[model samples]
Target: MSLMCDARDIEVNVTWPGGPGTNQRLEKVPSRFAFAFENEDVKGMEEDCWGFGVPPGARSYGWFKLLLDKARKTEYDVEDVAGELTNGLLELPTDMTAKEVVTAYLTKIYNHCMEMLEQRYTANILITTPIDFWLTVPATWQAGAVDDTKAAAGSAGFGTRDGDTLNVITEPEASGIAILTEQAERNPELIKAGDNAMICDLGGGTQDMQILTIKAVKPQVQLEEAVPGQAGKCGSTFIDQQFYQWMEETFGEAFTNLPKTKIGHGSKFMKDWEGVKAAFTGAAPNKQYYVPLPALGQALGATGDHGVASTAYDFMDNAVVLSGEDVERFFEPVVEKAFDLVDQQVSSLRRRKQGSTKLQIICLCGGLGESIYVWKRFNDFCKDRFKGAVKLFTDKQAWSAVVRGAAIRGLNGNTVLSRKAKRAYGIGVHRPFREGIDQEEDSYHCPVGGKRAVGAVAWFIVV
Candidate 1:
């Protein structure tokens, strides 16, 4: 499932043999949840008043998963979480803690999936057949955050039924499986065993890059990591942030002075920006794009410079007209960060192979991965650097690659044979203290033998 602000952010795809032909069904649900109150009496509201809609005065808590991840290093408190929430485009409710908000959001998604399943195949099927859940998490997520996700899923009733199970895999791995499987089926000649291919999973909030070597093509596909994965917070959401920043700079007080309650998250201005963002391809260098300014419609009159001169943009027809160069300014930085990640992985693979091996394929998958401008930039980079030695791969299903891969993994099984550690991990051990070598602060007396010892770290795996 995707947690972006897009309309088709959360998707549910079922693969069962008991249903109709192909036995596969897919549904896209808005990644939106709201809690509406009637006369300040929130406690008396039914469950129907919440979950999956844009009702009037309802609050949408986007990116709550980030808070769950943050809870790993810091304590989980309402005040801290509330502060983080308020710092964003949305505000948190005073009565609910961050955990409660996440639980509610997940539970709502779960219930909606279950209702769809019951409608597709009668409720009897749900009761009789065992159900297994496979979830995809960002590769950059910490182990503690993954555990938090599992706990939240359990609280949402997953793995609660008899014979039910839940499994979690990194989002890049899932996308790799789906893309490799599709490539193997459609064009087997494009890739073969022992060839290294880099997978770039660019989603809404994070970008993960990994290199994998094909192990076997026959008797089911198998894969092994060529190098450890790398990830960063440079995703499509950053582009949106850049867009908002541009609005503030270009429009001045006419944009910032707007009422926060009416022009904050989920506003019409953002909705229009989404359209403009998706349509931009950097294909026409001389063409211009326009985004409607519904919130600033009246403010445009007050500014008095609506049609006035500007090097990058102009205000006309109650909209902002941006040149192609202006649009590229919003996307170039984020895309370049992603390119840096890809370069790091490629450099690692080159070092491992002693500069003898060449990267055969570069797979791009996820929401931002579908950007035509992004694809063009990568294509040009590969041509100039690799001299056409690398083949770029992407598809129309790039946004749903993670969920589709999860469904494929649930139906079949894991295709990965081995993986490399992203970083070094070790255990702390007590060693006999050496007067000259050990630090005084690290020395401690052993309880078993009453001997002086020093704390030391034993590394088992190194990146």
Candidate 2:
């Protein structure tokens, strides 16, 4: 920070509370309080309290499912909370809004950075210094949602630095920017100018895609969007939904209906499933795996051992036996959606066939994108479409790619240019309608120009 006193190029490493992937965790440094929250547990998260020494009236908490149970008991609007997490904001209480949670998290980070940087410089330098923040959001998020995130970040004290500005970039584009910059650092020739690539960022909450065309090499890694980015709620969590359904089928309605907190044993099932999903290569006809179920005690309660309980489910040996064939079904929906999105993005560019729209590279990143199954599916798609010409890249740091990329972009490096607009743009105008030239009924006087113009669209832009 001292060297890059102009926050534009400043770099600081930090961690998010209970992130979706392992890369989000900052190890090596004492975490002040090691904590994480994931899966459905995030639905009930109300707040986070972390800092140095005994902060006034602090409540130390861990990733516990009981938050959901508590949320249901109170007037905590869960539907609104879930909406806030996925979308942008909801008309909920200040403490319960996702915006508040995110800002608070960022505030903690800001405070930590100040504490660390202030040690080397006096308050005069620290107070006068300018620091800019760049936040990354999912490509699927609407403009309003991006604005909401920017507003939240500003509230978190990040807006106080420098020009009181906060920049927002799509997660996929940011990762692409980081990769492009790194490629240049290694060897400029590795990624030649005009090279076209697609960034597939499949994270826990959303799947974001961005197609870019390299514009320059010598000056810096500049990029232009060959096609508009596309994204949706197609992430690993979708697979979890399928597994939850399997639980309902394998166990019983009682298990499915039970509150998240009461189902402590389900955690074991989730962990085991993650292992199975990770190691699974392909469909093996006879291969089978056992995912243990919660014990059902003899007392016959929801929390009891399986067979003996009336409400709890019973397994042959306290496990749900799943075959490789059955496991494939659970992932098909999510994997298929990802395939479709990629195909759609690539197809759009191919149809246009303008300005080196060739997608030579397909880079996958994020927690779900790292899956062997996901890689194979995309690789197969690319092989058939490009006839083995497209290269697939998924490095080890993919989980942290977005953050790293956003950091690089914060340094004020231009990595994208001429992004294809997500939506079509056209202007409404007035023109005289002639006989047989336009439909008689389609003619109408222009409100502003007062001229009879056909109610026809010009379709000025192809995309």
Please provide TM-scores, in order, for all candidate models, with all chains considered together: 0.79, 0.67
303-327 per-residue lDDT for model 2 (tens digits): 4444523222334455556777777
lDDT of each: 0.69, 0.60
Q: What is candidate 2's CA lDDT for residue 259?
A: 42
Tens digits of lDDT, candidate 1, 364-406: 9988888888898899988987899999989678888888777
Cand. 2 TM to true fold: 0.67
lDDT of 2: 0.60
Error of model 2, residue 405, in angstroms: 1.2
lDDT of 2 at 247: 60
Best by TM-score: 1
Cα deviation at 278, candidate 2, in Å, is 4.2
